[model samples]
Target: MNSISSRTFWVSLAVAFGVTLYVTSSVLAPFLIGVAIAYMLDPLCERLDRIGVPRWAAAGAVLFGFFSTLTAVSYFLIPFVWGQLVDLVKHLPEIRTALMSYLQPALDAGKPHISPMVIERVQEIANISTGTIVSGANKIVKGAVTGGLAVMDVSVIFVLSPIVGFYLLKDWPELSSFITDSLPRAYEKKILALARAIDQTLAAWLRGQMVLCLVLACFYMVALTLSGLKFSLLIGLLTGLCAFIPFVGFAIGLTAALVAAAFSFDTWTGWACVGFIFAIGQMLESYVLTPRLIGQSVGLHEVWVMFALMAGGAVLGFTGVLLAVPTAAILRVLLKSAYGSYLESDYYTK
Candidate 1:
């Protein structure tokens, strides 16, 4: 094939493959998650192997350590989160009353002609109760019925992941060699350079973001609790995790904290303290945590990040959002390199 024909063929094939993957994404979710886990663990496994551990032994050790850590976190954190959610649900009525009391004056002052219908709708939504005990009991029963199947699925992935990861990691070098050897002779070097650049960018993003989330979560919990906020741990951990979704963490965390402050303490002093706590947290995150951990060089603007997240969510639900930023970053680097090459070419200069 001529260069143009070859490029067209490859692009068409890529589009077809992407469409096929999208169509089958639900079934592939577990495998995708497993691959991500494997990717993260591969480095640790390699380090162990370099220190004289056998590949199988290293993989086993890494998997065991991963599960053990997960179990410990679940044991401690799950209950705390669950309790907070339960309490929050239980207090919904009171919270609604407090919210109305807080907002009634503002609404009256801002819009004298506000319809009662609108106010009623808002009040109805706010008064929505989760009825924790009854709801919890029903959920438990439903969960028990569904849990068996979920467990089976988890077990299958758990079993398959390490095996797949082991072979993938073990054959990683050979796989790279095979791919490089098979590439078109003319494009081989350029393709390899692009691949390496994409890999490094993704690795930095995934690993760095994970560490940042943990650090932020710890900081949020300590700061909020010291400020005497209710459900500090739950709210903090949630906020940190949601930080992955751009501005979502700040919005949710601040809103929750503000409401809790409104309810828990009646004094303006209490409210001011809550506001100051979040302001301090934001400042620390901006000035210290993010800079120290992830740095500003991920090369994505906040607006672009938000757009990619929304686009991804629209296309592929949660998985798309998860994959979007790294994918965008990699594509951005490739495009920049390609554009630079074009700029240096005779056709572009002319």
Candidate 2:
């Protein structure tokens, strides 16, 4: 083929790929989530295979167990969460009242020093923040359950995701090999080494993060329940699950927990206990769980991960958000390789 024609063909393929993603973005969430599930389960599948389980059977076993647990949770756990959400929404006024009760003493004490304008602004900020927190949560959860788009997405997750995951899990090795084989010969060896490193490290990191989240969730649930938190189960689970989102999850969970604490407790000690639970959770994650599970670094910074997620969601909806981190990690790896080459070149030697 002529060089120009070849260039056109490649460009056309890229355009087609982008167009396809845009067209199918609405339905891509379940499929993308399935892909992630398959990737995460690949190690387990491999382990089962090594112990005399056929690859297909191993894939089936793992996927079945996972989806079964997920289905059970959707059936039983979700309704409980919904109930907590409803109760939380109902208690929002009390949370605000309690918050003001605590704030009023300080406001009165500083009334002469703090202008009325400042006091008004402070009250407005607190009201809006708390109101937005629960209201936003209510809207998102309800929309996911009842929205027209939600039906299709949720159905796909139930019916289609397992099938997608099964095939991907079973074919993982061949798929990896095929990708490596498709690279150009000139730098194939160099790239293959980098690819393998990326594959191992990235996979380990993702799997570790999943484990970390689960561990944190269980810990929070138990700890909060013991502390007599009114919505201990709800707060603990939220805190645990959200642990994966860097600071955002912790912030949402902590804010909710603190509000619940203020409303539920008469004593400052109960309030302090609730605050310490979150403080301990954060410290545990930073000093212990993260270091042991995901190592000290995973190439992608917190800011970059947040940016990628936001940008991806903005561009491609839920599917984009799901893929953003892995895609960013891959690009960072490649860029690092290019940087190394540049340093060795005469251009850099000068």
Candidate 3:
């Protein structure tokens, strides 16, 4: 086939794949999660294999360790989070009273013309209730049911992940060789170089971000706990997790901490402490955690990162969010290549 025809065919194929992906996204979440787990464990499995462990055994060991760690975390963290949530719910009346007291003066001063009935109705609707709790529980149950369905649909992927991982680990070297062998000899070196660059970028980003999250979580927990904040563990864990979403995590965490602190202490001192803790966390993240962990890897702008996250969330919900950064990294590589080609073209020179 002519070059033009080949290009057209590849472009059409890509479009078809994208369409299929979008349509099948609901069932794709588990498979994507499995793939992410496999990808993260692949290096460890390879290292074990290199030291004379069989590929299957290495894969099994890595999978076991991974799941064990997850189980341990869930055991401790889940209950902590649950308790915090229950406590927060139980104290809703006090929180509402505190908020009303804080806001009433401002409302009165700012909007004298506003009707008291309208304000009271707004407050009543906003008030936390048993019905709200029940509604939340119902939503959780519905979500769990849907999640169960998705799990059942993707059961094969979950069951097969370790199996697939074993072979992939064993054959990784051979697979790379096979791909390189199949590529056009003229472009083989270039393709390999590009692949290595992409791999390095992705690996650095993943490992660095994870470490940053953990460190930030610890910092948050210590600071908030010292500040006498209620639900410190839950807030800290959430703040750290959300930290991955750029500023959104810190903002949510700070607001939640401030509210909790205010309710707990009923004074500006608590609010001041809340602010100080977050300021320290932010300072550490900006000056210490990010610089030390991420370094100069994956140079995408914060705006672009935010856009990618939002786009991914819109496209595929949580799974999309998980995949967003890696996908953006790959796109960055492709864009860099295209730009380089354009720069070298005769039309550009003219």
Candidate 4:
């Protein structure tokens, strides 16, 4: 195909794929999740195979470790997190009361400087916002539980993901080779090179992000618990999970921790401790952990990543989010290659 035609064909194919994924999102979530899991674990499976383990055995081991970890989290951690959520919901009124008590004095002091109309409007808005927030929060929590249960009852994600992951991991080599073989002979080398680049980029990001999440979770959990914060475990784990989304995780975690501290601790010292804990965590992540673990040269920019995540979530919900990074990585590789080719062509050289 001519270059323009080729580009058009690929773009059309991508759009079609995206539309199909969106249409079948409800059913595709499990399969997509399984594919992601398998992709991440395939390297380890290959490593084990290299070290004389059978592919099936390696796949099984990975699955076993995964499920064992899941079991532990489900038994020990989930209950505590659930309790904290329920407690937070129950105490929303108290939280609002305390917040208002703290802010009211300032409002009163500024009354002389501020118009009575403005004060009344502010008060009215605050009350409305607080009511909406509390009611919405309560509804969201209940709806989340109901929605999760409904999904589990209807979808095969819980049951099928592991099975799919296991088979994909086991057959990874053959599957990969088949893809390569199916490619046009002239494009094989370039396509394979692009695939390798995409794999390397994704592997580094995903693996590093996972490690970062775990370490941050442990640090936050321990520090907050030691600092005597309420619901520290839940807040800490949640923050860690959010860390994958760049700034969003840190902002959410910090806000949650601060609110909890504001309610639980009577002294300024407790507040200071919470601040110190998060400050140190942020510094460590930005300066040490990320630089060393995630490396300095991930090709995708933060804005691009944030955009991809938002776009994915908007279009495909959870499945889009799962596929976002890899898709971004693939497109980056392809675009870079195309740009390089363009730079070398007569149009650019002239």
Candidate 5:
């Protein structure tokens, strides 16, 4: 129909999709995870199809191989990580005690600037916060009976996500064709251009982040384990995996690593070694890996990414958080296009 009506229809359609995501948030986790897997694997499947492999076989082979590797890694790594986690939980009191011993001087030094009540409350909390943290962690994992993630069932993610990914991968060509055919004829070129921009930005981010995560994980795991730290893999790998989130991931991972180091070592030399390792990680990520892999051309500033994630999490819960990056990237492209159009219009020239 008319431009105004078409715009209204698309906007309304977007809002409805968002509402549907929220309503089906529980189921959305596995489906979204599956969709993400499928999206990432689509390129490989396409390549296989072009090389004389049947599409169904290609999808099946890729899915099977990917999941097989994942399952194998999990099978071995999970037990070790779980064991470390158990030991770490058991020693939380000692870790807390050791932590407070180091921080007690800082707490005392802050007495003049900080209120006595606040300092006193902090010490009180420090005395028992470990148990609270452990309890909370326990509750979260206990919720795993449902089969997904926190609030969603954790176990279901393993079974459901891959299944969803497999089918999506198999039908991806048809899906892409359907979507392309449905675009409004008048605006199809513009829409396709926007889609391509978003695709490039998103693909760069997803692939780069995956590489960054793995590289960082390997670095941390090897370095920390070499230095004799406990749960090095869990800490390192998690830090690396979450590295896509910017500072928060590294900070959280570093904090845990430091705590574990503190508990594991007697001297400041050991702590210094651990600190050095992470410092190197931060420098490596900021200076080396990120620029080489993701680059600055994508317009994904750390601040914007963080803001999008936080806003998404606030507005739509976990599903929002999962979608935040791609959605923000798409919006960024659209906003850029809109701005260009606005600059070219008579309103700007007048």
Candidate 6:
């Protein structure tokens, strides 16, 4: 094909893929999750295969290990986390009352600085907000309906994702070979280089982040539990999961720990301990965990990562969030390559 025709064909293909993704995003979540799982486990499967295990057997073993971990979490961790969640929900009113007690004084003090008429108008609005309340109730009802459907979706994913991962892992080698063979001869070297770059960036980030998250979760769980905080496990798990969002996880986790400390202990000693634990965790993450693990392999700036996360979430919800980092990594590689090419081109040289 002529260069123009080739470029047009590629651009059209890209547009088609984008449209397909947009249309199927809702159903793609589980498959994407499975792809991630399979991607991570592919190396292990390969290692096993090299050691004389059949590819299918190696994939089966990995899947077995994955399920075992899930089963363990379901049995031991879920119950404790669920119990804490229920207790937290039950005491939310009390927590709110406690918060209001502290906040009310500040609000009251500020009220005197504002116009009396403004205060009166606000009070009147608050009193006549029944329609707002009804509207909120309707939203709650709608959310509940959405949640019911989400639960069904979750059920499907829970069953399907592992199976998807298993098959993907099993056939990964064949798939890779097929794809590599299908690439155009002239562009094969460039495409392979980009693919390898993507693989390195993605694999390093995902594996390192997983390890980092697990370590942080254990640390938080133990430290908070030792400090005698209520709902420690749940809070720790939340923090660990949110670790993907950079500083947000620590901020949220620290806030919860402080609240729990304040609620559970009257003295400043518990608060000090809580603060100390979090400070130490931060130090470990900053100085030890991140550098040793994720480092610069992600190849996206902190700001870029944050933007990618927000944009992904806004566009694709949870699935978008899951895809964001990898997408960003790939984009970074592509952008760098394109910029390098541009710098060498006649347009730049001129």
lDDT of 2 by residue, 34-82 (tens): 7988988998999998999988999999998997887787797677777
Each model's lDDT comes to: 0.76, 0.83, 0.78, 0.87, 0.87, 0.83
Candidate 6 C-alpha lDDT tens digits along 1-350: 99999999999999998889888888898899899989988888999999999999999999899889979877988879877876766665566555545555655776969887876675566435533544554565456447877678888998889989999999998999999999999999999999999888878877988998889998999888988888899888888877767788899899888767756777789889989998999899889998899886567676788899999999988878888998998998899899999999999999
- Quote the lDDT for 9 in model 5: 92
Instruction: Report the number of clashing residue pairs per model.
Output: 0, 0, 0, 0, 7, 0
How do the candidates rank by TM-score, highest first? 4, 5, 6, 2, 3, 1
The lDDT of model 2 is 0.83
lDDT of 3 by residue, 232-334 (tens): 9889988998888889999989987876776878678888888888998899888988877777667765677788999999988876887798888888887
Best-fitting candidate, scored by TM-score? 4
Model 5 spans > 4 angstroms off: 107-119, 128-131, 137-152
Worst 10 residues of 1 by lDDT: 126-135
Estimate, for each residue in 1-350, the C-alpha lDDT of model 1 and write its tens digit.
98899999999989998998798765665566656777788889779888998876787788778878988988998888778766776665676678778876776665557787876766556445423433564566457447998778777777776667666666555777899899989888888888877777677767777887787788888888888888888788988887766677888888888878877887898888878877877787778877776677766666777788899889998668767886788777888898999999998999
Alpha-carbon runs more than 4 Å astray in model 6: 108-148, 347-350
**Model 4: how far is 54 from its true place, Å?**
2.6
Compared with the true structure, what per-residue lDDT tens digits does model 4 show for residues 1-350?
Answer: 88999899989998998788778887787887789889878878988999999999999999899889978877998888889888889988887777677678988999999999999998888888777878988998898677977766446787888889999999999998899888978889988999889988888888898999989998998899999898899899998888888888999999988878878899889989999998998998889999888887777776777888998898888878987888888888889999999999999999
Judged by whole-model lDDT over C-alpha atoms, candidate 3 comes out at: 0.78
Candidate with the larger TM-score of 5 and 6: 5
RMSD of 6: 3.7
Per-residue lDDT of candidate 5, residues 33-133 (tens digit): 99999988899999999999999999999999998898898898788877766666666667767888888998999999999899999988876776677
RMSD of 1: 3.8
Report the candidate with higher TM-score, 3 versus 4.
4
Off by over 4 Å in 3: 111-167, 182-186
Better of 2 and 5 by lDDT: 5
